[model samples]
Target chain A: MLRIENLNVSIDSKEILKNFNLSVDEGEVHVIMGPNGVGKSTLSKVLIGDKNYKVNNGNIYYYDENIKDLTIDERSRKGIFIAYQHPQEIEGVNNIDFLKTALMARLDKPINLYEFAKSIEKLSNDLKLKENMLYRNINAGFSGGEKKKNEILQMRLLKPNLVILDEIDSGLDVDSLKIVCENTLEYLKENPKTSVVIITHYPRILEYIKPDYVHIMKNGKIVETGDYSLSLKIEKEGFENIGTNIIEDNK
Target chain B: MNIINIVNNKISNSKINNKIKLKENKNICIDIIDNTKLYIEIDGINIKSNIDINIDENVNSRIFVFSNSIDSKININVNQNKNSNLILNSFYKNDDVKENTIINLNGYNSNIEYNYSCIGKTNKSLRINHYFSKTNSIVKNRSVSNNDEIEFEIIEYVPKGSIDCNLSQSSKIINLKENKCKIKPILLIDEKEVNASHSSVISPINDSDLLYLMSRGIDEHNSINLLVNGFLVNNLNLNEEEKHILFEKYIFRR
Candidate 1:
């Protein structure tokens, strides 16, 4: 459903992603494991069409359509969603209002307020978010866990076809992580065609949402691709121990 | 809530409500002796007026001043007695408007909270003088200009012997066009045992915030509109009806 061919991305004249390649089929779950500063998050930003990340080479394909020139909003309307590593705290923008606007834009039609409110209430309850949070500004004064849950709520509401979760488990507690993963799993069950790309530093979240493939990213490119066992191997012996032999063997 | 109207230097008091049609070159005086809430509407064109307000001791009052005028100059003076509390919310939209406001805390434990929002060419200055101990003041001003320049100067002064006073001033101006905007927040404290803070920002709508909103599939124009609405309407101490009126008249109309 999503394809990146020889993607070379840079910001401020410094290259971040060089010769990066990845592919995800419909209904596939791909987990990307990488250490800090390995350009994992940069890949996610590039996928979402952040203008700051200049694509110096290659193209991004969404369902075989080249989306390299699409704007951020255009990519979002095309069913591409990225849960940011650090969600922005926008003051004065009410959370419910923002979600309603987004939903309207995504559907390209005005929605029934009653249905929208009901769905928001149910989703807030499922995510263990306080009802008052719906009235507050977007992510303003929200705890780290609440911000992550809010992102998941938007994903469910928007029903994107391709989801890129950048370090979704960074600030979540055990229960919050469980709730978030369960919500995601429920969403996937309802929409079987949805594809997920999980970006993380550890295999903790993988225990909840099992992945079809695990790719280890280093220096802005995927070095090794394996099944779930690769995540466990990397966990047992850190990224430093994953040597050139393993990369060659995997290739 | 009492609604008072002064039209063309004439006063007609009703038990419930009225309107204010300010006349050119006029002086208006208002004295509040009891706890009351007031909604004052000042509507005029090319008028100059001076208003004096006095609040008696131990009284609590809230006033909302909605001014829709053009090419007007207005001066407001307010005095608060002991243990009085006042909340003033003022909104202005005009082609050219100059407003000067001075507030004096004449007694101990008096408090004043002032909120001002404006659009178009405006020059506004406010000074809050703390004359007694334990007085408090909070001043917040937000302005937006599409073409003409807008300037705001807020001064909070605490003289000597006015110990334990708290003063704060926050001012921001959003210049949508190429017009230059200014915000000057000054805090003059002669007392040692007082808390004072001031912050000011004058810029266009934040680009990162706009991008964040747009990433949710909202177009750039709508995203900017939402941001401008939030910047003007949020954090104002207004009731539902007042907020709706402000939104319809000033924010949405733009």
Candidate 2:
């Protein structure tokens, strides 16, 4: 459902992603594994049209529509959602209120308040988030795990067609990770046509949610694509050993 | 709650359980006692007024002051007696407004919490003095300026003998336009035993915050409106009705 061809991204006139390319089909799960500063998070942000990231070359196609010129909100309304690694803490905006506004904006219609409230209650319970958190400010004073869960909560509420989980496994405890993974799996089961792109450094989360293809990203481009065994090999031998031959071959 | 309308020099005889409406040019003094809640509405054209409020000993009171005026100058003074408690919430939206407010902790063990929110061209100065031991004061101010300039100067003072007093001041201004907005928080503490802190910030609405909001499918205009409303209306001790009225009259009017 999403395709990127020879994408070159930069920030502050310094290139970060060089000739990056990837494609994800509908109902497929793609996991990108890489070391720190390999443009994993940058790719996530660029996909959502982050203003700081300048697209120096190439284009992004979502269902064959060029989205390079679309604003962040436009892309979001077109069913692209990114769960930030570090979710922002908005001090005054209520969590539920923000979700409601976002849901309304995405659907471009009025919502039933009773059904909205009921859905929020059910989702919060499923995520193990406290009911009172809905009444509090968006991610303000929340624990790291709570913030991650909150992002997942918004993902469920918005129900985007393309989901980019940027380090969703970071800062989560064992139980919280299990809950998040289970909820994600449930979402995939319910919506068989939604596509997901999981970005991470380790294979800990892969144990819960298997990927259709695991791609090793190095220097802002995919160096190797393999099955789930590739993640296990990296875990055992490390990223340095797995992608050395590819880099030497390119050199 | 009684609704008392004050216009010109007319003063309501009812002191407690009242929502007082002040209009036009007027000077009024009120003494609150026996645990009460007061909602003071200030509205007029070119209003100039002085308001004085005194809280009696051991009394706990809450006051909400909402003002929607133009070209106004208002001065409010408050005094708290022994072991009294007071919570004051003030909101102002005016074209050109100047306000000076002073509060005194006159008796031991008294405490006060002051919250202020405003919009438009305003120059507001506030001072709270701890004249007795074991007193406490907390002041928080939030303002938004679109085109016109806004400035807030808040001061907290404690004398040498006012031991064990606590004081804090926080002021922030969200400048929506390329206009000059300033926040000054000053703490004058002569007592070594007192706890005092102050902080101030003035800037445009955060771009990252806006991006985060807009990434959730909210348009730029609606996202900004939501943030502005949250900054001004949230955390205030206002009922739903009062918040709705403020949003419709002042926030949405922009």
Candidate 3:
């Protein structure tokens, strides 16, 4: 489980997340829905400890241990994975090498190359990715949808205890969305303890994964926390009406 | 055979003129000492020599001198003796040493490969020029210079109608201090039928590649050494013994 209390984050002296708080329990899928530039992605980057995002004030706890002093790689090793909305394209480093290196870093040992390839191949087939992609550079020249699938591949291979997916549905076609959602579902089914924090704007992906809890964020803070019907209500009424409700409630 | 000589201004200098008409296979080792001017001419156009040298071939091989003394000059004439293969190795270490090297290839099917390594400090400048005229010939050259307060310059010219030959040139400089080092590699291609390619990359070590490796728990120096080794390994064609010797001499510096 992961917990955040009054998490304050800023980039270049501009505050983005103002006293944000959230808690994710094991085996529960939490979907964070918000409009553009409302700190949905900032929350994920803050959790992943991106150097650009400065933590001005707050505390983040992963499994009841304070991880404020841990490095980004250390946090990753401690079962925190972030499937980037735009995965980095690393040139001259092959996909297989990158994956194996990541996996070895997680396990802290030299993994068997043959078994690694076999396991990745099985995952690739499940995710409907071409096996030949492993020979190319990591994410280089990949289409937008292909890049999203590659992120899922890493998530599957690493299999962290808590996976934070930031906007995985944006650029995916219907078929790709289906495959990505199905693979995620299958992963959660296999590993029952793995928790997920899905950040998205559209409710299409929720149609497949069926999030256990949904939270609506606006202007750097979560204004509503409810069951899946909140997402359905927002989809029907839209953010314009939702904005009016937020102002009236405050008044 | 004709001999060409030019002496614009005299510093401390030396002269060498040799002609071998029938020496088919020759092993020649020429050493340019510090603060000494040198000149040599090759005659008969049929003698083949394997030359090994030490200087900074990256920048102006004319003005820069790597020596303890103030002045040095060198003049070289290389004539082909029946399509020869000339292998040259040069090294430069000081900023006060100034030297000049001029080689002329006038035989068909001849090949010249020159490799140089230079470490400069306290104002080093170098100048080098080579001319090639023949058919079915090749030239492979590379240089490495590292340090601060070193100004290095190199200019190479290849004329027209030299068919069926290729030239490859590269220069790498590692600046460990606040020294000025410049690498100018020039190639003139007048014949459209010939093939020539040149690449020059002068950059400091990449921090991202280092951090990426270090994030995986690799030692800092080991990651740097790995990247530097990868850069230099492409420059040398090393036999087992030469590779081991270079590993100890340049990399480990023992």
Candidate 4:
């Protein structure tokens, strides 16, 4: 479980996340949908301990332990995973080398290269990725959808307890979206104790992975909370049309 | 040629210029043509041999210089004939040294490949000059410095009529500690159609690289080791034993 209580975050002295709170329990999927520039990506970046974002106040807890001062690697080792919306392109670093290092970092034993290659081959085949991608540099010259699939591949290899996916469905065509969603949902089902926070703009992915709770965020705050129907309403109308509905429901 | 073991050497103040000629294609050791040039020292030897090499037309040769001396001062002069190829590969771990090498490509379409790698905290001054005596000649060099105080001055001179020649230099300096490393590649080309390029980089292991490596559970120290190894040992055509020797000597010893 991960908890964020009244987290006030700012970047470059400009306020971003103000009085924000969210809790992800075991065996649950939470989706946050909002308009652009509403701190959806900021939440994910802060959780991953990106130094560009400064914490003005508040705390974050991972499994009841305060992770406010933990480094990004420490947070990663603690099983808090974030699939970046825009994954980093690191040249001259081989893909298999990176994955093996990550797996080694998470596990106490040395990962067998044969087994690792087999798993990567299976994942590559299932995602329909290029066969040579494993030997290529990380995300170097990959298409946007290919980069997204690479992120999902990392998620599967890392197998963290709590996963935060930021806009995983963006840049994905229809077929790639289905492959990504199915792979993610299958992983989530196999590991029912894992929790996830999916931050996205489109509701297309929600059609596959049902959310236990849907939150509408605007101006650095969640304005509405309901079942997946909130996302459906927002899809039918727009963000502006849901404000009156939130007021009506709250009253 | 077999490279000998290292010995604690002393500096010597003697100079010997030995001339060698190649009419037919052959591989030759440095001491075979110029074995009488000896610098006297107590514990170990200091090599101060000046070599002048002249190659005939269509001759191909390779020269290997493996120095285990702790102090050395060497100078080399080269003249190549038409369609000839010269390969010079030198590996050294010296204490302090001043070395100069000059090549004159006097024949059309001649080629030279000069590879060098050095280890130790020595003060090194190296100057390499390539003079294009004819059209369509080429000279290329690759060198790596292992945290030494080295000032390299490389110059490629092409005359106004020397056309279609190629000159390139690639040098890398891996610094684990703060050190003085300077590289100046001066291309003095009078020809309009000649190809000349130079690239030199002096950087420690990049922080982003370290972070990316450490993100995979390689701690900072081990990450640095991996990156330094990748930078220094990769891209070379060394055998496994040579690579192990290089890893144990230049990269890991520092």
lDDT, candidate 4, B1-254, per-residue tens: 22322233222332334433222122211332322212212123565655556666676666544554546776666676777776665555567666677777877777877666665544433433334444333333333345567666677778787777777777666666667877777888887887777887776656666665554445566666555544434434354566566557544543
What tens-digit string does per-residue lDDT give for candidate 4 at A1-251? 78888899998889998888888889889998999999999998788776668999999998999898877777887787888787777654567767887888777578988999999998898888898888776788999999999988888888889888899988989999999998898789878999989999978899999999888888776778888898998999989865444321210
Cα error of candidate 2 at position B60, Å: 1.0
Q: What is candidate 2's lDDT per residue for B83-197, written digit by digit as tens?
A: 9999998888888989999999999999999999988899999999999999999888998888889989998889899999999888888988879888888888888998888
Model 1 DockQ vs. reference: 0.62
Off by over 4 Å in 1: A243-251, B5-25, B44-49, B159-161, B176-178, B188-194, B239-245
Tell me the TM-score of each prediction against the true structure: 0.91, 0.92, 0.62, 0.74
Which residue pairs collide in model 2, if any? none
**DockQ of all predictions against the true structure, Cα-based:** 0.62, 0.72, 0.07, 0.23
lDDT of 3 at B47: 25
Real A-B contacts recovered, model 1: 0.51
Q: Is the docking of candidate 2 incorrect, acceptable, medium or high quality?
A: medium
Model 1 agreement with the true structure over B1-254: per-residue lDDT tens digits? 66655443334442332221223234677777788777766666785667777888998988877777778787889999999999999887778989999999999999999999887899999999999999999888988878888988888889899999999888888888869788888888888999988889888888888888888899888887778767766757876577778878656653
Off-target runs (Cα >4 Å) in candidate 3 are: A243-251, B1-254
- Candidate 4: misplaced stretches above 4 Å? A241-251, B1-106, B110-130, B133-152, B167-181, B197-211, B233-254
| CA lDDT of each prediction against the hidden true structure | 0.86, 0.87, 0.61, 0.69
Query: Please, what are the lDDT tens digits per residue for candidate 2 over residues A1-251?
Result: 89898899999887888988888999999999999988989999999999889999989999999999899999999999999899999988888889999999999999999999999999999999999899888999999999999998999999999999999999899999999999998888888899999999989999999999998888888888888999999999888866655531111
Please provide, for model 3 over B49-90, each residue's C-alpha lDDT reduced to its tens digit, 9 standing for 90 to 100: 233333222111111112222223333334433255555444
The stretch of ten residues in a row with the least summed lDDT in candidate 2 chain A is A242-251
